[model samples]
Target chain A: MPIACEETGRALTVRVEGEIDHHAARQLMEELSRRLDAALPKSLTLDLGGVAFMDSSGIALVLRAYRRMVALRGSVTLQNVPDQAAKVLKAAGVDRLLPWNE
Target chain B: MKPVNEAKLTFWSRSANEGFARTAAACFAAQLDPTLDEVNDVKTAVSEAVTNCIVHAYPDQLGLIVLRLRLYPDNTLEIVVKDSGVGIPDVDQARTPLWSTGGADRSGMGFTIMESFMDAVKVRSRPGKGTTVTLRRRIARRFPG
Candidate 1:
């Protein structure tokens, strides 16, 4: 997985590309959590435009991020979610927990 | 239903191989002419089963995983994922969502996802031996005569 992030003011935008599966999610969780702790952004936006595939593991990562953001009194949004990924999220009922940006 | 097609896939116990296994299964089932949604369901379930093997089965050492995909004449797709690693001691507890032996990083919903996506899921395991997970989903297609 290729992930690039930039911070503007109190928001952090993370652009993730490629397939997000169990293997990639492990490293991604660690990296994003570390960045989340440091930046302490008011909102975290995950841009999934380039994501071609995702599984339940990807949903777990998003949920973890949402939990962390809630702890900091912030929020998280999922943007450009692929159709297949969106189906998984809907099945898991994660679409209700977090907002969709696009 | 009688099986019309079958495939066996073997890979290392590495996490990077999880995606490969799922995509491979999807491709194997594609010959049955399953819809995209059905294929996604299969891919998602395969990922969960394979992830369990990588994260829980052989966390310390790399092992081998055998994945099988069978297509029945009735358009039913059966996916089997087997691992010769540390087997689950308690199958009941492991099936509970949010119940994980790993750590907070694990969502512990692997089994739940598999059961929800597939029509039927059967898991067979033995302590100190190995574990095998079988998932079946009937595609909305009929074999052309």
Candidate 2:
């Protein structure tokens, strides 16, 4: 996976590309954790527009990030999730907890 | 008739298992006459099952996950995923929706998705032994004149 981050005030927007399966999930989580810990962003937004495939592991990654942000008294949002990935998230009810931008 | 062509592979109990499973399913489906969406459902279900083994089965320990694929002439595919880790203590509770052993981030919907996507799913677990998950899907047959 490819991850790029941009900071706008206290919010950090992370753009992730490539497939988010089990192999990439750990690396993605570790990288995100490192960035989030250092920047201490008040909010984190994940851009999934470039993602082509995602499994339950991807959902786990999102949930992990959300929990981390919540613990830090922040929040996490999902953006541009494709229909396929969105289906998995919706089934997991992740859409209810984390705000999404279409 | 010959039994369904079978292929087997074993991978280390790592996160890569999920990728291996998904890719294998996709590749196998491409050789058959299944729709893209049907293929994707098969891939996703196998990916979830393999991920479960990587995360919950061995935890941090290094182990092996065995995968078997069978393609029947009737357009049915069977996948078996097996791991020899600390088996699930309670299969009944584990299959419950939203009942995850992990933190809040875990939705505990892995089994649910697998069952929903595949035509059949059977899970066998023995607390000190191991766990094996079998998933099968029937390829929609084309009508003949």
- Assess each model's interface with DockQ, reporting 2 decimals per model: 0.65, 0.46
TM-score of 2: 0.85
Clashing pairs in 2: none
Point out where model 1 deviates above 4 Å.
B142-145
| Model 2 Cα lDDT, one tens digit per residue, A17-91 | 888887787788889889899889999999999988887768888888888899999989999998778877887
Write the residue-wise lDDT of candidate 1 on B29-76 in tens digits.
878788888888898899989999999899899999999889887778
lDDT of 2 by residue, B9-126 (tens): 8889877667777888778766667887788788889888888888788887978989988888878888999999889998888888778885543558889888778999999999
List per-prediction Cα lDDT, in the order shown: 0.87, 0.84
Clashes of each: 0, 0
Report the C-alpha displacement of residue B98, candidate 2, in angstroms: 3.0
Q: Residue A98 of model 1: what lDDT? A: 86
Model 1 error, position B105 (Å): 2.1
